[model samples]
Target: MRRLKWVSIVAVGLLISLSGCKIVKNPDPDSAGQADANLTDEARMAALARDIWDTDVLPTVAEHLVPIDDLRVSLAQNEQAAGQSHGLRPEGEANPWNFAVSGSGSIVEANTTSRAAKLQVDTTGDGAADVTVQLGPVIRGTAIRDAMPFLIFTDFRDQIEFAKLAGGLNAMAHERLSLPEGDIIGRTVSFEGVFTYRDLASAPEVVPTALSFEAPE
Candidate 1:
């Protein structure tokens, strides 16, 4: 009788332990749902630029596009306010205007070393350019990425990932949007792009998000 009672108690304990193991192996519905949500967030971040460009940028461009010449004037008039109102602040630092601009021009010169091609655009479409547009070969700075209202530092897992995302966007622009050295010379081009401003006299070196060109016939 004593032996039988001991055997029964051991069997019950073993069954309980096995059941606990199964529960751990197969998560509950709520846990599974949370995991799925996390994955979705990560996927959303992976396509951050495309997602924001469609949802946020296009609409903003339609509504708020400042002509390149007009923007330069504004920056000259009130550098601080222009930057604060139009530009996105860097993750932790404060700076002057980082803004978007749109214009059309002919490529006056191409500088491969600086990776910046110069465009002669007449904001008024007169005989002369109101401002010179600098197109990038190496698009640096955080102006464009930070300018998007939808993005926040916390949206990324860490600063490293955020930097990678920014660099990836730059690479995408270079690959898909930038014109070849031979193709850009003497060509007419139109662009919408972002720049960071430190002073009025400095030229706006733009990293174009949208660009279209017409080759000389």
Candidate 2:
């Protein structure tokens, strides 16, 4: 009777321990506590830009940002001026508003399967950009990452489908982008309008840095 009781107790304990294996293996050992480490200066700045793009940019400009009727034109009454152009500075007038975006890219968070990226917008015309917008930080399996889910809105027809607009937006949110702020969080900004650019580096000047600001249709 003693042997049988001891065997039964051991079997129960083993089963309990085995049941926890799933829980123990759920965490990625390489990723444990890594989220808190101080990213290198380059890494931190890059991350800030990315956060702006993911958290700020994509949602704002996607089809739903502005009313279906609003996005019809390039500019809007509420939109802010981009400043003067670089070349024909009108003699004394401050140089043309030359803004550009460069080094745009993305980063994927392994654990949550979320993605973050940087959207560079320069208005000064100089190679380096003045303002930056981070957008996304989009979670995996969300409407943005996968299929489009219908949401009630004023003009769903004009609104760019969430998935369809992701490619161009992602192209804008490249990995190597930069921003003036070392730490970018809790900033109210906006980006709209369709500006053309040749490549990430040589794009147009002083283009708005949307900073994840939604599109104003």
Question: Per-candidate TM vs. native?
Answer: 0.66, 0.21
Residues 146-216 of candidate 2 have per-residue lDDT tens digits of 21222222322333443334443343443323344433322223443223222333433222224342222
Task: Determine which window of 10 residues in candidate 2 has minimal summed lDDT.
Answer: 82-91
Off by over 4 Å in 1: 1-13, 19-22, 26-46, 84-93, 111-138, 178-183
lDDT of each: 0.64, 0.34
Question: What is the RMSD of candidate 1?
Answer: 5.4
Clashing pairs in 1: 83-97, 115-137
Evaluated at residue 177, the lDDT of candidate 1 is 59
Which lDDT tens digits does candidate 1 get at residues 127-167? 55544554554567666666666667796779876776666
